[model samples]
Target: MEVSTSKELQAFGETSIEKIIEELREECEIEKHLPGGGYLHMSDELPYLVIYRNEDEDIEKGMDRATVRLILSEASFLIIGNKDFEGYQRLMFCLSEAMSSKFKSFLIIEVFAGDPESRKFKIKGPAGKLSTTIKVLQEQLDDVDSGYRALQLGETEVQDTLQRQPEGKKPLLDLPQLKDSGCLLLGVEVPPVYRSKEGEDYPVFFRSFKDDFVVALHKTIFHFIRIQTSSGVKSYRALGQKHLQEKVKEIDRQLAEIETSYEFLWLVSPANIRHIKDTFFETNYEQVLNYHYRLLPFDPDVLKRRLYNLKLEDVDDPALSYIFREKREELDLQISMLSERGSDSFFYNSMMLFGKISNDLQREAETILKEVNEKEDQDFKSIMKAEDFKILANREFDYFREQDKNFSSKVHVREDVNILMVSRGELYLPSDYKLNANETHALIQHEIGTHVLTYYNGQQQPLKLLSIGLTDYDTLQEGLAVLSEYLVGGLTANRMRTLAGRVVAASARMHGADFQEIFRLLNKDYNFTPQRAFNITSRIMQGGGFTKDISYLKGLVQLKKHLEEGGELAPLLSGKFALEHMPIINELKERRVLTPVKLTPRYLKSEETRKKLGKIREGIPLSQLINA
Candidate 1:
């Protein structure tokens, strides 16, 4: 069986059915533009054929674009605008016949506009013959409909005539003509909820069913293929657009190019954190301290102008366009935040980039705080100096280098960095960095095992954007990093409480608590030592009340929920992306747009870690994760 086909058309510019047949003979994927606004896209020579008749509804208006997205993603032959024009029916018949003969079994689904109310998906075909396929389609479509009203699908024999009629249009190909070619054709009427139909607005039902509407269409096609066709596709994602337009590729390249121009977090980070901390301590925590930031490389206004110039309208794939659009929006916000640094607006922008603390999250933080502090007096662990830790970090890098010769990871010790961080593949450590025994292992897993490993994994993918990261990916990044700490059997109670304390600090700051007040809350109330409390308070207070520290616990909570829901942990490590982007990630993987991860963290291979992973998958809570 042919598993792949080239997009470079053998027919060149010919739109004739004879030329189309010659091209389809090889089962090669071909796309052609017809004379009268018609289009034909075949992902490969699959038995599934999807037809969209463009009559009264223009492609610009409602579900037409979404229908196009649906067609491009599926392994089907899509013929648009052909049913309305004269002489095109012959092409549909010939093409359908050729494909049916090639595959031995074929299925055709023609999507038309349905009534605005009562039925969301209305099927028209031989009710008895297509019963199984229709039943599966109905079940999936029903799952698609949600909210106040339910739109169930039913079959009508009346609309099942061999020939289709459109208002003021040439007659569509009859069933006998299609039978000469050997294919089962079905017509599906979709409610034009996405369109407002000229003047009269659609009812409130449109709003209810529009969410994930295109995805629902995708599910319908996937089910029909499984139930009635010869295609062996196992996932709805196999129906996604395999060939991306050049415009989409250019936009992805441009966005990633802009992203590589500067690192956002490094800009927001203070250049004089240690100096400021010393001055604050010398004043006995009475003085209101001011923070300083690293100088930016590019003009913020110029960057904003460059970002807004990206034409999201040109990219047709909704999924790809959304990813690019989201990244552009995030970059704009980060640029603005950098420009507004040392002001109240900076704090607000930071909160927007990384979300603020929720009541439930704050409560979870409090619970962990209460549980951990009830034990014996807290004491710092036997610490390792920054110089010694750098040697160990390099040793870890060497191990990875041995596995993949091209792996070029490095470790650097500098007073300029905050504790330890990996940026652009190089791990940085503060000159005065110190770590306890348990922390020594935990930090390695958190940084090298998770962050650096994913960085290189993303590097192997075709889309360089994955290497940089998707927008708002920090939540999952931190969550996966923290989880790695546990997987390696190095998660200490003190570390868990410290994470909880960070959340408390964020919640307190959002509620208008000053630095001194928050420090005292952690130091005196939560029993964290003064120096430790100062570190926590300082993180939340940096860059004029930054609240990103809240993400540590928030990411942990989100990750736990994902694992319990049967979400795969391996995909999260595939690249830096949020937990919510799982569907998008899986879809891309099915489309062959993403490569397999280059390296698996050592912790994931351990028999001991596998036991801990089982509990996490079974829905263990965050505070109890330390014990796992």
Candidate 2:
């Protein structure tokens, strides 16, 4: 091994800085399995280094910068001032030497800082096959040299000359344009312009951009499209502008039909929810358990196969691929979970599917609601009948539709609905249920503003999966729903307590607590009304301990944290989606795989509502909210 340093290095351009950063990113990404049964971490936190065990102690953030030691048994390493060049080099050298003497293939040449005339440099290598680090560094160094020459000739002059060239003489593409195109074009050949989809043979040009790479870029873009000799340059196509639009339309059409065939919640829910009210009120737990679910109206296997046949792998766009693949898996899980709904098979299956409520969450709920006022406010005491709710819902629905004529979802009261449910563009409410002003506002935001708005926005997209939903959409969907309630100032302590109660009930059921036992706990210990306790208990105990209700508070916690961390709520409103899918959603938007949001929840438009949301950025944990 050899190492060298320079007192003065060349000034690097933005591209060089970016490439050097990229090299660091790649270097830090390496995860080596330790002999001590752990892995090294290139943590994103400051100091840019960490160590983590395979099963535990994988603390990801907030590592101490002062620490500078490697513990083999503990699987940790600390290096100070990792962001700086000397520190980075020393860290890497320390890391490499500390790992094992047997490992020797290491090389790194880096430019840390300074202008073109005077920059710092460090180089170390075995003088054999050049590693990726060395290659990127060398390329950057070459760019600096080229940059110096260009500066002498005046970069503006060269650029102006290039711009003044005739249309035929113009370069096929620019670097920024290539990056935005989302196609891997480095070293690889591509057609200058994607004119047709037809196949034809065309001659190809191979060029070496040894120096003056930017100048050579123009000639390389158009001539290198032909790779295989058999196919013409036009055969290797980027998504044409017209073709992308058409593809989006096709995806939209395909997704629109999913909800019709798969009514996810309705299918998975016990068909007897409406009729079981009396039985639940009467405390007939055994009788309730004996009640059968309605037979699945649609074929599960056929639906799974249909979702599978979506060919998400063929999408060619990473964002689109991720969206479709997740939708397919989500639909598949819904189908499989539905197969066990309302039967003894449901409970364990649900645990497997959605996981049991954690003790910490239950504890948090208890702490959060311990002091909340459960009484209805006198000023908002007037309750609206189910008919009244329908009027309000219709008005909200009309306003929603007015945003887009294509928004055709409607609202109505149904004898069978337990409270409120939105499915396939229809908002259903229980026939006899009445809501006070608070409840009315909460329901509108939760159902119409959130569920309905996302549905239509998703429908408007080329990819219907937004309408169909990604896997684990419930967590983010419910989180955003609960978040909407908070935004509208309807997320009261009592409402939050109810959510916490559901988690406690779900937790109790998961631990094998019986219905009456769970109900008793909620009613007596949790201070819930007998009716409210029974409702919470029955929801968790039904369909063999359905745990979806836990999302209310848990989702709130997650969403609140997301917002506090500067997450945007508008992207979430783009469709029925999840928190983890934000990256894919943003990526798709960047690539224009998905369109910009057209519909926003009405409450989100309010300055007061936004202020409420902003205040919650510090986070309104169930305990904090209840106390507030």
The best candidate in terms of TM-score: 1
The digit string of per-residue lDDT tens for model 1 on 396-458 reads 888788778899988888878876888866788888888776678889889998889888888
lDDT of 2 at 398: 78
Candidate 1 structure lDDT: 0.72
Error of 2 at 66 (Å): 48
List clash counts for every candidate, in order.
Answer: 4, 5
lDDT of 2: 0.53
**Model 2 lDDT, residue 67, Cα:** 16
Stretches > 4 Å off in candidate 1:
1-28, 33-38, 52-91, 101-103, 112-124, 132-158, 188-213, 373-382, 617-621
Best by lDDT: 1
In the predicted model 1, the residue pairs found to clash are 73-239, 73-240, 73-241, 74-239
Writing each residue's lDDT as its tens digit, candidate 2 over 24-107 gives 344432223222232333311112122211221333332311111112111123222212334233334433332222222211
The C-alpha TM-scores of every prediction are: 0.84, 0.61
